[model samples]
Each structure stands twice: as structure tokens, then as C-alpha cells.
Target: MSAHTQIMATVAPSARFDPDLGVIMPPSNGMPRSVFGRPVAPLAKWRRRYAACLVVLDFVAAVAASRTVVALFQDADAGFWDQRVLGDTVSAFVLVANIGVPLLWLVILAGAGAYDRRALGRGTEELNRVVRANIAMAAAVSFLALGFKKDVSRATVAAIIVGLLVYTVFVRIVARVALRRIRRVNQRASQKVLLVGRLADALAVHEVVTRNAGAGLRPVAIHLPQYPRSGERVNAPVPVYVGWDLVPLVQQLRADTIAVCGPASLESYELRKLAWQLEGTGIDLVVVPQVTDVTGPRIHVRPIEGLPLLNVEEPTISGLSLLAKSLIDRIAALFGLIVLSPVLVGIALAIKFTDPGPVMFRQSRIGHQGKAFKVWKFRTMYTDAEQRLEALRAHNESDGLLFKMRNDPRVTPIGRHLRALSLDELPQLINVLMGQMSLVGPRPLPTEDDDYRGDVRRRLLVRPGITGLWQISGRSDLTWEDAVRLDLHYVDNWSLVYDLGILWHTVRVVLDRRGAY
Candidate 1:
């Protein structure tokens, strides 16, 4: 094999790796020693410290926010104590019963798996969970007020909970930012993982985990049980740990996690045995489903008498859910248009004055139910963009399905910034308002029905979105496979909560200016 092929076979897929006991051992296989330059910190210690720091920050924020709310109420309503909502005979203690609000809030968060080791540094899951936990806390507090004859001011309580939620989320986000810095500046803080699956499955899962170092899993080795006995060195990326004996190699490599990419390597029985082996071993077990790109909230595991089944709910397109989604799309679109009126006018003027073309660029795009509609956007490209497309085909920076090029010559100077910031698509709000699109759904591709295939065509079931999973997740930078997977997953498991989560992260993604081009 060529030298490049040899290295590709065993490149020691990275993270904080032990130096002396290197992954992809050279001598044992007669191959060159795989380069894993990054030094590693103990995964156990790093997780513990990060989790502790976040918990401490949460406590501090809770106390500070609750106290501020109390002080504000006291100042605004001097008669807050005397003007009891319950009755005249209520005690001061009853009115100020929320003195333990901080403690209660912290406890609720902890109980909700906010500080979970698996959850600590994962992408966006912790923040989502924290919000849900606080919302639950608010509901519980409201219930207590109604059930018990408490004299607490409902307005004051609501303000305090809302304030606390904001502070708590802010603290967690800051903590996450710090953790991300550590991972970036020093890769050694990441957890080492051993991947076990078929070659294709393992590589796919490894790519995802490697891309999301914020998730804290760094695969250092691959074990292909299905294709064992080829050689001491199985020709694959990362250190190919030969054989189905995963439990032993995990200990030998000091691996913190054993990620089963699919159920292929270890069958159901063997998986159970492996779990039994790892009992009390402190080794994390992560399973990547054969079904890809699905989010956590949609997956439900239930045991029916003696059998466990994984139930994935189909994406809701009918009933009250769809109605509510439609309602939200129109309402949010109208509000956005109103709020951004000046900015819209400015963009229109810029497009008209700079480029000798119409203010709005409307092009036919496949929309809901395989219907074609004109999608609206601020004209970022020149009037002759289509004519120049063939010449620029060679320089297409994005995956081939979507024609995207960074610093394309056809784009106006102002259009570069617009596309970078995703402000170019702001006029899609009109499409959203007209029900041709949604505030959040899969982006409608400009493909004919003849070109649309089986599962891919399912994207047409709902109105095309201005921004959805595709917009927040790397945009044009994602591989065609990944882009399709994300869009299909979103369409399959659409939820109001999931849509809001996407919208929230959309802000962060835009700010990061990553993969925007």
C-alpha cells in the first residue's frame, strides 16, 4: 500500500492521548507510530471538576437573582407585606416563604440531571434540560400557591422564578464557554473513547464525536469484531483493536467510554454481557443508533412485559400540533417583519441602489406537499448570477447539492456580509407569513419532483422553512449525507419544543460565523 494509504489506515483519531502507551502501536503492527500529539488529562478528574464548577455557579446565581428579585419587590411595593393576597391574618413567614427559593431551585435542577457527567459538556443538551427543570419548578411553585393558602404575591413569585431561570441559564452557558475554551486550548481534557462497530458505522460515529469535542468524547481506538482475524492490524482509521473482546481492551487503553456505534459488533446477548462486565467500573456506555441524526427527546424505550422496544414517534403534521406550529410561524413572522421594518427597508435600498436588479429575489423552490412556490430573499447575488453559475461550478465550496461559494464574484460587496450573517434570507419572513414556508422547518430545495427520491421527498410534507436544523447545523458546510440526515430527522420528529430549541441555537450559530458560507 502507498504510505498515504498506510497512514489513513491508522491515524490515531485524536484527543488527549497517552504519550508512552501510544494508540495505533507501531511495532506491534510493523506500521509507523500513529501521531497523537495532544496530551491528556485524566477524564474522571476533568468531568468532576467541570460538573462541580457548574453546580457552584448555579448556586451563586440562584441566590443573587432571588435576592435581587426580593429587593426589587420590597422597594416597588412597600406594602407588599401588609397587602396579603391570602388574607389579613397571614404571618410574615408565610408571605416570605420563598426564602429557600435558591435551595429549592438547585435541588430541582440537580434532580433533573442537569449536572450529569454525560450531560455536562454535551452540545446544548444541558442548557435545554436546565430550562425544562426551571419551568417545572415554576409550575410546582404555582401549584403550591394554589393548593396551600399561601399569602405570597403571584406576581412577585413569577418574577423571581423568571429571573432565576435567566440567571441560571446564563451561568450554565458561561460555564460551557469556559469548558469549550479548555478543550480548544488544551485537547488533553477530553474523554477517551473506544469505538466498536462495523467499519462504516464506526467511522460515521467517530466523525460526529470528533466534530463535537464539546461533547467530550474523543475516540482513540476502533474495534471491528465483524471483520476480525485479518491481521494484528485491521486496516482502518484509528488504532484497530482486533477481536470482539472490547471489555479487556477498554481497561488496557484506560478508555473512559466504550461507544457502540451500532448493535452489530456486539449482539444483544454480548451487549448484555459487556454491560455486566462494566458494572461498577465507572466506564461510560454510549450507543449510537443505527437510525442516525435523531434527537434524544423523540426516542423512548419501553419494556412490554419482557421485550424492550424503541419507539420513535412520527413527526406530527396533523392535529393541534401542526395547527400550533402554523400559528407560531405566522405570528413570529409578522412580529419579526414589524420589528425589522427599518432593517428590511435598508436592505431593500442597498440591493436596489448597489445592484441594478429588483429589491426582492424570488425563485421557484419545492415547498410543502411537492408543490413549487417562489421563495423570497434579499438579492445578494448580481442579476447575472444564474449566467455565471456554470463558470463558478468548479469553485463551489459547499457540497454539490447546494451551489454555495464563499466570496463568490457574483455577490455584491454588501451581500458578502449579508450572506455571512444570514441576513440575506430575512425576506423569507414574507414566505413564512404567506404559509409558503415556516419560521422553522426544512429548507425547500429547488429540485423537480422527478429528481426527488423516496425518503428525501418526505421533506416536502411540510412547508419549507426559513431556518431549521440545516440552518443552525453548519449550513452549507455540512456534507450532503449529514444535511439530508438532519433535515429528515427534523421532519420525522417535529415538535414545538424542538423547534424553539433550534431557534435559540440559531442565534449562537449565527454569532459564531461558522460554516456560514
Candidate 2:
């Protein structure tokens, strides 16, 4: 053991000395030894303001949907107005509904936790809740209409429901986009975090925070459990400190959150004691486990007796979901081919005339289950591209089994524009229809790089893709390790919704052209 461990062991002979949570607990008095005023509360006023704005937007959407449907579908000349609904004329009933529906929508939204601060501006949970609430509202209206034997127009009700769902979802998406942009510019709406753990783990969490600016965690300082040595260099970007007293440090730093990353030494009881210290101080405690890349949907918390067990479901690799995915891929690919036939032909003609080469380039690529398939693409390189590969190897800008050059001599002039816009990938729809590729999955590797072993082989569990997490994330700019990590993550967490999200993001990435060659 090092000097620090020896000192800790000698200081507390019987007490549990957790390496991550090395702070010595106070006596039963529950008072901090050193009082540095009080821990500052995070800037949560924006969450309240944001939630209030959403409420207003949702109400407006409900009102517009109902009123528009009523005006368009309701026949003013029809004798329906003469009929009474709950002791009011049909026209009066319409007015009541215009007010009641929006209120009901708000209530449902609240019950579904759509206005929750935790869900706002993060993940798909808020949108999922909104969808659920709208669905509940539709069911409730249908039930009330059927039960009361009211002559409510089914067509009008359906239209209002559909309109409300679409409009409200669109509004929330726009709000999220705007909020992300604002957060990137101004971090006042973000969480002030005091990172705690070993240096490596803390740095990892910090990297994640920096990468995902919208997550709203700004690390102010890091608290290491070890004593600081004089002249010892710490490579962290944030200020680093060592001590048993954390509350005072948090207060001094004005950090409202303590993120414990990969805290291996702390028992559950000891972690609970740490939570006690933050009680009534409004300090958020976040524990980041060692598990990486597992998304929220796959993790479930099961409380049995007093132990809260985390159950991680197996990844969806096969079964009905895969079958549905396959069917959708083929159907969409066929539709795309038909709709984009003219553009495809134009591109083919362009390649034939400008590049003086074949319109299509077919290469042997490793696909699902290590199967080799001919992946097709619009020819974007000279006919002697393969012959020129040896000469350009010295100028390669990528690492480990991938060759990437920002300006390759083998690429035709027209090829550069096609690649920048990702137009060359359009022909891969044929591969999708042929069951050799997916509309969204890990991008297939050329046969030369097919040294599948260990974790690298996992990428082949699903069919290769026309576009994937790698394509939208950074493409050629990403290191080989990062590319593999992303591909493996997509393979382990494959879902229909995820695929759709990737496809949607692909459009933005293509337009941005950040990492494309």
C-alpha cells in the first residue's frame, strides 16, 4: 500500500476506508466540522420558466387544433346546432369544448410528467410522455362520447386529436432545438458540478459533459480522495483538491452538484451517508457507474425488499423486432429507389461523363455474420483508385484498419462534391433491398480490414448500413477506437426508434458537412 493508504488504515483501524468516498464521517451531531456558509442552490429558475412556457405552448396547440377542426368540419347550416348537448345548443357546446379540451390536455400532460424539469431538454422521455398524454386524451374523449350517447362527430374528434398530437410535438422539438442553442451560448441555465472520484474516472465524466453541452453539467472543480503532493502535476482542466470535508469544498466552490464517477470503494450504506450530508442543502448527487454506452431504455431499477437491483436487458439482436426491421428496410429501400430514380439516373450520367468510369462502384464488404457482400455506391473515385491506394498510404490521415485522406489524388473532381453531400451513398438502397445492408446500422468495412476478433466482431451481428452512428457522429474525423465504440454501441442498443433518430440526424450532419471528406 502507498503512504496515503497506510495513513488512512492507521487513522481508522476498524472503520471502512472507501477509496472513492474517503471522507471521515462526523459524529451523530449531523453538523459539518467547518462551516463555509451554505451550499449554493443551482440556477433552477430557468426550469420553472421553461415548464411554464411549455404549458402555454401546449394550451395554444390544443385550442388551435380543436377550434380549427370545429370550424372546418362543423356545418354551420346543418340542423345539428338545434340539438342540445348537456342543456346547451351545439354552438354553445362548441364554445365549451374549445375551453375544456385545452385544459384537459394540460391536465393530462401534467399527469404524464411532460412538464417535469428532469425530462425537459433531454432525451426522448419528455416527447414519449407527451405522446402518451395525447393518446390518453383521445381515449378519454372517445369514451365520454360513447358513454353519453352524444352525437359528437367522430371525424371531427379524430382530426382534433391528430392535429393536437402533431402540433404539440412539433412545438416541443423546436423548443428543444432553441434551448440547446441557448445553453451552448450561455451556461447560466446549467448545473454547477463538483466531480469526485479517481482522476481517470473523473476525467471521463468530464469529457462526456464537455461533449454533450446540452446535458447542462459544468464541472467547476474535482475532489480527489488522496492527499496532494507538493510539485505534483495534475493534468485536469478543473481545479483539484484533496480532503475529508466535502461540504465545505462544495460551498466554497459554489458547486450545486457532486458527481461520483466509478466510485468502487463506497458501500451502499456509506454512499447513503454522503447523501445525508447534502440533505436540505439542495445539492444534487449524481453517481455515474462504470458501464458505458448503455442507454436509458435498457436499464431498469427493480427494488426487491430493500436492495435496489439494476436489471440490464439483453440487446435486441433477433426475434420479431429484427423481422420487422428487415421488412421495413426492404419496403423503404424499394420506395426510395422509385422516388429517387430520376436523381439516381442523373448522378449516373454525371459520373459517366465527368469521371469517364463506370457509374457504380461495387466493393467486397464484410456484412452481417461475417458474410461478404458486394456493397454498391455511386462511383466517386477514378478507375485506377485501387492501383493508387499503395502510393497514398503514406498520406493517410486515419488510424487502425481505415484509410482516410482529406484530398486524395484518386478521387474525381465530381466525386468530391458527391461525397460532401453524401450523394454517392444513395445507391446503397439497393444493398438494403437485397438484405445485405440496413437503412441504418454499422457502416460496413472493406474486405481488407476484415480482421474480426473480440469486440470488433460484434459489429457484424447486425446487417451493415447505408448510414449509422459513425456516419453522423464524426465519420472520417473520428479515431478508429471512437468509430468502433460507436458502432458497437449501435449494435448493442439497436431499436426502431433509434434507427429513425439516426436517419433524421444524418440529414443534419450531411448538411453541416463537418467530418465528411
Supply the global lDDT for candidate 2. 0.79
Relative to the true structure, candidate 1 has a C-alpha RMSD (angstroms) of 6.5
lDDT top scorer: 2
Give per-model TM-scores.
0.82, 0.86
Question: Which residue runs of candidate 1 sit more than 4 Å off their true CA positions?
Answer: 1-43, 75-99, 123-150, 226-233, 394-400
How well is each residue in 25-112 modelled by candidate 1, as lDDT tens digits? 3223333221122233234778788888887888788877766675667544332323334346555434353445667877899888
Prediction RMSDs, each to the true structure: 6.5, 6.4
Q: For model 1, name the residue pairs that clash.
A: none
lDDT of each: 0.74, 0.79
What is the lDDT, from 0 to 100, of the residue 156 in candidate 1?
78
Q: What is the lDDT of residue 390 in candidate 1?
A: 99
